[model samples]
Target chain A: MGPITGEQIAEKLSLTRATLRPDLAILTMSGLLEARPRVGYFHSGKFPHQIVAKKIQSLLVADIKSVPIVVSEKCSVYDAVVTMFIEDVGTLFVVKEGGLLEGVISRKDLLKTTLGGQDIQKLPVGVVMTRMPNVLFTHTEESVWSAAWKLITHEVDALPVVRKVAQPDGSDGYEVVGRLSKTNITRLFVELGEGN
Target chain B: MGPITGEQIAEKLSLTRATLRPDLAILTMSGLLEARPRVGYFHSGKFPHQIVAKKIQSLLVADIKSVPIVVSEKCSVYDAVVTMFIEDVGTLFVVKEGGLLEGVISRKDLLKTTLGGQDIQKLPVGVVMTRMPNVLFTHTEESVWSAAWKLITHEVDALPVVRKVAQPDGSDGYEVVGRLSKTNITRLFVELGEGN
Candidate 1:
């Protein structure tokens, strides 16, 4: 398709060029349209989702993951609650000896446990943690697409990125490397929008 | 690119046709790949986010918006809290005479108000409601992309889908039509994933 001039768009909409400038700026900045010095403007051939998907593809887990918020599996539910509020995160990665990924605990998990009226100070977080195999994870080489999918599908707010390492006993175990959350994705989205 | 046969893919991966069949079937059903009767299989040219974005584009606010969980502007904070919990929603639309959208009240707003230790049963929700020109909204004709963007950029969970209507006394006011929330977006994502 031929590049469209702002004049043409304004005319087609029966609007003044002044009235249309802001909307055009928004569309171009969002990557729905593109402008060239002399070539006028054209559709970017990228929809919002396409741009986001491309961004997700370009990002490696290592580039986007942050230090994981972790809790010892044996920590008390009360301690977990305090740690959660202190850390200001919605979920916590529960680990066993040597930072091995064991399970995950969410705000709801802690809330439900606390509401049970058990001795929160003595009750282990391990009892309420979402165990292995059920906990979703991403590896260093994986794209954020997979991580985001796990988030949307599992209806969870975060995932622990892990790496498979050989244990002292020669068994394979996952070591928590970092964490990925919706906040990271939103930050990336905002960055993408700036460049669009 | 030319279509590739299942046999070729299986051979390249060092797997039997039987072992690879189900995985191929899953990918095909997910809209990541396409199969032609005589031409074999080809990449579908749609990524995960593209599928989601397309779904968003095709959806109108009117189709997905839910009945607005609303409260009268004159309603007390205690009543608003009760209405929110009863409706099982995190936000409430505060309306004036004749259902004109006057303001918005969120759970956080109610919680903060209650924590002040004031008389909740007497203090009107309008006292704390986010008023006009501040409450973000969408119209029936708007796409889900615009709605979702408002959710992300404004960092709010729900939006009141509204329509501009002429007031009896001569100005214009917004009539709350329905509500759009993050849960709606996630539900749409799950639906897209099912056949993608």
Candidate 2:
């Protein structure tokens, strides 16, 4: 009911304790399941199928921005690169003074723009990112599958999950919450697939 | 089979021929099904699940570089924004004069760094864009699915589809090619699911 143990997992799937080791190794390395020695393997309880990846759900954009990271709107392209290295992240979220959702920047986006050999210190990141029209988003509680689908369809990476906190025209203030990616699904899947 | 005609499709699927028009329109727009002026609908005959986006293709890095953009490892952060606007790409690829890949930049990355007002314009992109310990590459022959998988697994937006055009150490030489994104797959899927 709560979490599946390694012994229980091995019994359910009919895999030998020895053969199961390899898959277990892969699963653990992939961040799917965790081995607890005496506790067996603990499932993170995060298995996602293609169905979940494509289903849309409600989201809060502010929740995502809440994660402590540098916030910017008009910095030099050079500065963006530095933050990426310092933070060790592939994507960065851009917001206004009020944390109004602006756009996003990713490693690929930066790489593509930097290839031009323009002065990085002089260039504004705004010139390079997939802007307003190109950005895809989701509501909090939206299906991971839906968020994933948007990523695929938009031909872009990462989706800002926002909840209508207070729409200016309406009564909602769009806020970014959780950031969803396919990696999350894969991590969950690997854990469930290899119970060893 | 050769191809499915509109009448045949309508009859076989039990849907009115007229009703199927919208789905057909979407499929064609996504570059999956081909229509030869009422020649019915033929599969794109490219990637399997061509109608549904089963396999994703690789990107040629060289082709991306050939798109006519400017990059600068040493330029001030302010100039990068100008290049991004002129290029009309969501991201940029950073590499050396000899075509060796370096780092990446995205709109969000720049936005975050600049928001705090740390004199980003004088900074080099090398200061903010992602550096080592976080780069992933894909070979030319690998399916787009593989690249997609990497994006999902690594929580990144894109992959450098490289071909070993020439390997100095005989390890591998990958020339970047074609860009594949989630949008491509999402578009294909919307069409595939259109069927009743």
Give the count of colliding residue pairs in each prediction.
Answer: 2, 111
Q: TM-score per model for chain B alone? A: 0.73, 0.54
Q: Tell me, by DockQ, which candidate is best.
A: 2
Off by over 4 Å in 1: A1-56, B1-196
lDDT of 2 by residue, A1-196 (tens): 2455666656654556675566566445433345776677654333222212222122222322224233466877778888877876557667665665667887666765665557778888877766654567776555444555566656554566655566557744545565654344333222222222
Quote the B-chain TM-score, candidate 2.
Answer: 0.54
TM-score for chain B in model 1: 0.73
Could you tell me the lDDT of residue A145 within candidate 2? 47
Model 1, residue B126: distance off in Å is 11
| Candidate 1 structure lDDT | 0.73
Question: For model 2, what is the alpha-carbon lDDT of residue A152?
Answer: 60
iRMS (Å) per candidate: 11.8, 13.8
